[model samples]
Target: MNIKQPDWEAIERAYRAGALSIRTIAERNGISDTAIRKKAKAAGWERDLSEQVRKEVRNKLVRGEVREDQCANPERDAEIIEEAAEEGATVVRSHRRDIRKATNLANLLMDDLLNTIQRREEIEDEIERETAGDESGFRRSSMLAAVALPSNAKTLFQLSSAMKNLQVLERTAFGLDEKEKSADADELSSLIDELSKDA
Candidate 1:
């Protein structure tokens, strides 16, 4: 029997995206539930239906459709209630971890942005000093304009425009455009020759 290997990453992503059931994931992937469960355990994936159930209960309660006591069966659903509570705690911890990771990433990006701004300012000052005696003022003004920071809205707009332009350039460069055109042999040869000259 040829056993197909499951894509563990895909399975894990699906699980994280709220699939949350070993049997459900296994059935979807045509794998054994035990295999899925093992992989999830190894990946430290948490399953929490309590949060979802709580939200649903809250909504229903607000609409006067269900009472608080009806949320769980005290006798028959004791084990399920305990499991949900434990999983709910796990979910809260997981969310806190995710928030920390996001905060760290934001800090790192902010540092990089500040460094870039500082470097740009240093370069501008150097250029200004160099062009101080030029008398033309054209070079200084042009360089300053080139490095000028835009207002928040303008910055967002410029970034969006730049991203679109980059996407277009990439498509054309990689011959992934609708025309599916690539560089001719002569162009390719010329590029190779130019690169070889640098060597």
Candidate 2:
């Protein structure tokens, strides 16, 4: 009986490519699986498979000759899966950050609108009190003139318009309608809750 020497170079190439099982490579090269395993371990070739290798493995699996378990280093395959999952998670986190930023800006706009309205009301009240007092006609005219300024009215109108637009945007972003304002608010609250929970 005659035995052939193991082709170490060919075995290393097949193992590094990660497309074939040690058993398959051994059979193809007319060597024992144990010999290939020992040579691969000695050469420190235990890493994740390349894309080409994975593709080859898929083809082999499709042909129904090789089972998934027959592939080299199941742990390396699992690590690859874990890395892909983490990449997906990072994308989700980025989207969440963008949503929170927009929400925060909307909240700030709402605060500004509330403060402006309050100030406008306070000014109107002061004007009414001055009109009721025994002030001179000249002073009363000046007070009314301030109230009737075009710029002041325009500013209030613009602020109100901005508030309305922001409200519309919030509703649109949250998949709600004008009539569902409360639902939009609730959705935002729930989103915040979700974000906090993730934190």
Candidate 3:
């Protein structure tokens, strides 16, 4: 029967140095957990408990939150940087002033965009009101132009009312026409036809 023996020296050095997981070391050395643990014990190696505890504490620090010791506590920040150096990880700090400026600029741009949308809606509403008033006037004028029929004219009131409406609509059209660079002539022609229907 053959008994397997693990390389104790390598396992001891890795354990004392606070290296990656036992699984990672196992993969690197092409060995199993039982072999690594047995070898570590044989070499009198103890895990760097402080390094492990520090790792757990740092994991709770949410990414991008300004670290308390980044500038305020040099000792704490130095310790953090040293720990990171030992782990071969980079430490980066962001400029608070630059972040604040970016936040303000983003807020300003959002406000400007919202104001622009509101103004556009207001302009659209005004144009719609003008167009509706113009159309109503046109219809009134067409009905009025149809003229009188009999002494007991039933439709006389309706015709006169339509003509009066057209006169008012023609006035409203001028205001709406000036708002845009170009007016749709076809739409004006359609309004005229609608006005003349009763005539």
Identify the leading candidate in terms of lDDT: 2
Candidate 2, residues 43-101, lDDT tens digits: the string is 88653443423333233323322223644656555444334333333434555466667
For model 3, the run of ten residues with the poorest summed lDDT: 88-97
The residue ranges of model 2 lying beyond 4 angstroms of the native Cα positions read 1-77, 122-199
Query: Model 3 over residues 84-193: C-alpha lDDT tens digits?
Result: 33442221112223334454655565465445444654644555565575746665444333321332144434445554554454334323333433224233323323
Residue clash pairs of candidate 2: none
Candidate 3 residue spans exceeding 4 A from truth: 1-8, 52-84, 91-199
Q: Clashes in each model (backbone N, CA, C under 3 Å)?
A: 0, 0, 14
Worst 10 residues of 2 by lDDT: 180-189
Off by over 4 Å in 1: 1-68, 124-199
**lDDT of model 1, residue 88:** 36
RMSD of 2: 19.0
Q: Report the error of model 3 at residue 80, Å.
A: 16
Tens digits of per-residue lDDT for model 1 on 42-103? 87764433333333323332342222354344432333333333433344344445545555
Candidate 1 lDDT trough over 10 residues, lowest sum:
57-66
Q: TM-score ranking from best to worst? A: 1, 3, 2
